[model samples]
Target: MLKTIFPAALILCLSAPVLRAQDLPDYVGSGQCAACHEAESQSWQGSHHQLAWTEPTADTVVADFDGTRFQNDDLTVAFSKDAAGYHAQITESDGTTTMRRVHSVAGIEPLQQYLFETEPGRLQSFDVVWDSEEKRWYHLYPDQSLPVGDGLHWAGPYKNWNARCAECHATGYEKNYDPATRSYASTQAEIGVGCEACHGPGSAHIDWAETGKPVEIPGVDAFGLTMRSTADSEGWIQQCAGCHSRREAFGDGNPVPGTPYHDAYRLMMLTPDLYFPDGQIREEVYVYGSFLQSKMYANGVSCMNCHNPHTAQLVAEGNAVCTQCHSEAGNTEFPSLPIADYDTPEHHFHEPGSEGAQCKNCHMPTQTYMGVDARADHSFRIPRPDLTPITGAPDACTNCHQDQTPEWAAQQIEAWYPDSDKRGPHFGTVFAQSAVDPAGALPDLLKIAGDEGQSDIARATAMYLMGAAADQQTARATAPLLRDDSPLLRAAAIRPQRAAPPQEQFQNLLDLLSDPIRLVRLSAAPDLLRAPVASLPPRIAERFGRVAGEWQRSLGNRLDFPETHLVLGGTALTMRNTPAAIGAFREAVTQDPQLLDAWVMLVRLEASVNGAEAANAVVEEALQANPGQPDLMAMQRELQQ
Candidate 1:
């Protein structure tokens, strides 16, 4: 029998009645393993993974509840603890002070967020947060006073714990959302990320440990879990990207541990929405996408090499973690890495033991999100200070030396190493120039997209930008990528065929309708929708309609955000369902009143369906909120005439 160490605190937290895997379902609670795998379980005790989310008990609750009132802009929130539980008095956008009970606590250390169940299975994390280190309550968006009905509001869908946060925070979490009913029957085997969250369902593994019988579940590994599915480094990294990367999931999204990333979720590329042109972290990209761009990733580096997965901590603290592999003599594991004194002033250009001497300071720059959450970029690119003014991407040099300009930083680097290959023209400058004038940068983008020497992700992103102002040349540049093995490139190639005739585009994109990846199939939907359906063979048209329906359903499933509804409205227009388009546009403006495009579409729809009078009313309404808007003003003049 494996001796398991169960701390008194861990035992108390695990006292809740759970749905045992053997009795009712697949997930055995994490607590069930304490008697067997003691060391691993004990090692995980009090880890960030273990405490990501917890029931708001006295010991677990780190915030002060001594009737403290914190004011953020116009709103004043009062936190108090009663006999029943911890509660907050929050003033709504409509000026109603409502009492909300704290249902659960999320995060620890620098900050802690409280979850409130506004409705059954519709839990929302209140915007007001407790800064544990500061010992004070502060709004998550201290500077921005978002109104109550806004999606970014604490009570709105964006902050909903089930859809946004639950998947990663808990084990065996089934969102179980019903789009038809607008409700959630959300269930989790154990609250907070647990043993099964990473290792997969533990019933067969536990049985094997106790009875010395290996469960012969097909596809199950020797540990009796569906893990270690592939021996390659990329396959293992997919296990981490499932949660770590910002992505869109397909189907039920109940991905088993080690499920192939494409089989489970569509990993987002370096889209302009998430990252800067240079592939530096510009938003709340957790880490995976940035890490994929690193030279380290190219040379066979992995998360497990530097961090312990169980404890969720660095394997070694400070610079020592990096020195293990990046020593003076490049190890056999990384024969390509040149021999260099990484720790000395020769490489770092900083005094030994200074903040700038840290490997991460020079390589992995930091970007802050969610107010207090500062995460370091994992791309590990050498700082190109020269690209700062050109591309608007932050460089590591100016990040530390706030007063100095990027020009000065670049000059200093050139001064330090006159012949250093690190200081060279980079993709950042190209991406920045492309964003400003896509026509001007088309040649560079084409070169980057076709070159195998460049990062495939950067290549794919260039193809994505190619969709704007695409010509015959752009089509020629991207046509071959449709059959590329990488789905990212395959999906991106479909968008840049503007000059090609509709039939030609349909012909090029037809086979991708049957592409194995859901994202690839979905990407082909719009172009296929333009097919001469009446002229196609009966069987081909049927298949086309089927794929189109699947793509529409995929769009419908993600109507939680205004962005999705915006897409829904555009798709509806393409399908020639004017009423559906109108409804979707209305929903979008309801979520975000300032969405000028939605309002413009509404005006266009009203003019077509009803009359100029109806269109004029919408235009006037848009101008009231967004006065002097050129598009609306133009419409108003046309309607008046």
Candidate 2:
């Protein structure tokens, strides 16, 4: 269990600061932006991005708070509105009632979630939400019976608005979390995602405007914006992906707008829990990760090509959005695209007016999330029922055909296009095969890692999955990819090298300690720490210190997260700091009592350093938090003996 959990902790540390309003001198509000760009600002009004978060008001609070009572199983919540504001009285299974005043509201269309100040400086998103379409209240997770202590409960850390949601919802947000006191002094420049959220701070641009708006040379930012107008497709895409993608942020709140995505956050790759093996959305992965795997993204397509930046809506309705490039009269913007008619029934194999004939229904299947919202896949992939059996990933055909098997769908695909070349082996086959048979799938995984034709994300994911089977042979095979041009591949390639000899590890990671990308250098710093830094040359030691400081700061930014404490505890244990490890483990379990491994580690350390009585006391606390656990029970019995 230690081996399995420790490696993950290292990765988490590699993967994962505060500001005040007065600290941000460059951020001019969106109201200032509207003065120069009225048309864009007006278009943005009432859009989801504009209303992502707002204070509770008569206009904003749409839920029925006229003393309405909503009961679910043993829990009953009464919502009421007074001159003060919207409020909820929640009665638990134990019949204890607590009154909570709504501090803010999130979203507007399909559903709206209320946020309550559960603790001083800590805002939590309530589970019960209002369905705008149905005009009724409902629980977001109707299936689960999450009690007060459960992490999934509304008041838990996972539901923290400041830590989890505020960065994306509000512009120029800073989650000022003080770890010593375990509290937040959060601040934001504005209530919602405004002009500066994507375009960066506007003070410089305002200066540019007030000083007669001097014209500058081409490629120079005349407007003084962080996101340059001359930015290419990839640069523009990263701007949107900074907030849209499901990723682990590196620092406090969101990074400055227009910062490189890799520098700000670690993009989650195609992992089994978050995505299907075929790179379809399995969880709420948002758009960026799936888009990275698409041919559209490969051909220089970006978010703005389909979505209006200001309005956050599709550029065109239905098939017109796709046919701009896919149709017989191809778009001039993409001269390389092959002209083809994809919206016809002959291509989709359905009646022209039917739902099956829709381009999105096949290429971008919708997955329902939050019970009411349905988000379409952005991969823009062709329907390949043939690969479903091999990958165990859902196909577009069988997803809609409730009674049909994947084999049936594959047969139909074969009957329609017998000579098609789309049935060739995909990387998904190798990824899925790796799960059940790592040794057998390793050769193919290495091949995929080296395949330049595949997306860098896919190659990086292949390298990440190969960590389970790390050995000298696997490390040697993947060594060439360590110097790959892509930062993602460079970062992932370091994981497998853990199997190499100590001298080999030192030699291989020395250059990466000063790698151009911060993420890559941070990735190498942990593995390089195993070597004695003081014994190294002066220049090399300095490089290690700089990168190690970056790694430490990255961990410091995420101290609010319970798992970050777990990583701290693991790092302390590795450095032979027993007391520090004990403190970290204690903090981890205190923040999240359900953290079983932290409790176990804490008990072990207490028993060694203190006494069996101290360990027994911890065991009793662990049993109270997680009752009837075999490991804790066994530990308790041993301590008694």
| Candidate that scores best on lDDT | 2
**Per-residue lDDT of candidate 1, residues 1-641 (tens digit):** 00011111211111122222233226888888888878989988888889999999898899998788987566888889978999999886568898989999998867899999998878999888888877877777777767766556777777888878888888877676665466888888888888888777888787778888757776567667766534467776777787888888654334677667775666677767789988998888888888878888878888888888778899998998888877786577878877766878878889899999999998888888777778999998888897888888888999999999999999998898889887666777778777778888888888888877777678878887765667887886688999998887888788786557766777888899789887788788766665554456667666776666666555544555566667767766765668778988987777666688999999999999999999999998887767698988998999999
For candidate 2, write residues 90-167 as lDDT tens digits: 998668899999999998989999999988999999989999999999988888877788666788888899988999
Q: How high is each candidate's TM-score?
A: 0.90, 0.94
State the TM-score for model 1: 0.90
TM-score of model 2 vs. true structure? 0.94
Q: What is the lDDT of residue 361 in candidate 2?
A: 90
Off by over 4 Å in 2: 1-25, 213-220, 532-534
For candidate 2, the per-residue lDDT at 55 reads 89
lDDT of 2 at 465: 86
Report the CA-based lDDT of candidate 2 relative to the real structure: 0.84
